[model samples]
Target: MWNYNFYIYITTNPTKTVLYVGVTNDLSRRIQEHTENKGNKNSFAGKYYCHNLIYYEHFNDINYAIEREKEIKKWSRKKKNLLIESFNPDWRFLNNEINQE
Candidate 1:
């Protein structure tokens, strides 16, 4: 059996005014879907231009990924920004990082 890694990701707009959190087993594809606006407009990410990935955490367990996503969604903007800064000080779009890898 193949094991897929799961991810809890946070994406923001170019100005970093909007934030969207989600969990997915296929991080790359999910990010692509968000950028393509393939998700429903009712979604926070889809409603806003929150396709620039700013931070992400990987997990082998789906439940853990979901739990982390929930926790992140509940965080205040400041807290979220801090989390992103810890890993991405410049808040660079992670799409390029993904593509490079």
Candidate 2:
């Protein structure tokens, strides 16, 4: 049987003042699209330059990934920061890390 991979991810601006939560099957490609979308006023990620990957969670099911994304979206900034700090205390951009794997 074939396995499917999905992801719930968070991205932030360079100054880390803005956050965007989303779900995707292709994290790298999606991040790339976000990068390309930067400066486009119509997109929240683009408008805020929220292409710097900061946090992510993988799921085998798309529904689970979407659900988790929604949950994160509803979280307070402090809660989101705690979640990010749990695995990434420094809030380092994780694009390179995910691409290398």
Candidate 3:
């Protein structure tokens, strides 16, 4: 049997004013890319500076992670806020934490 890691994550700006939902197999690398892509006006995540990880969920199946990302992307901002708050009430940036663990 084989197992793989996939992540559906939510990241926000430093001000916590914007949200970006995405799925990736390498969470740390993905976050790094996001950080590097910051200030890239062509990218939604980059343009908004939504690189502060606030919440994430892991999955063994990539399909499930993609599905969850799409579902979250369709929700209203208010709904998304509630979802993030439920998992990360303080909306703390988790980029450093992920790497430390």
TM-score of each: 0.89, 0.96, 0.96
Residue 1 C-alpha lDDT in model 3: 72
> For residues 1-101, what per-residue lDDT tens digits would candidate 2 score against the true structure?
66999999999999999999999999999999999999999999999999999999999988888888888889999999999999789999999888887
Runs in model 2 deviating more than 4 A are: none
TM-score of 1: 0.89
Candidate 1: tens digits of C-alpha lDDT, residues 1-101: 66779989989877889888889888888888888883457777877878899899999889899989999889999999899999999999998787565
lDDT of 1 at 66: 92
Candidate 2, backbone clash total: 0
Per-prediction tally of clashes: 0, 0, 0
- TM-score between candidate 3 and the true structure: 0.96
Extract clashing residue pairs from model 1: none
Estimate candidate 2's alpha-carbon lDDT, on a 0 to 1 scale: 0.93
- In terms of lDDT, the best-performing candidate is 3
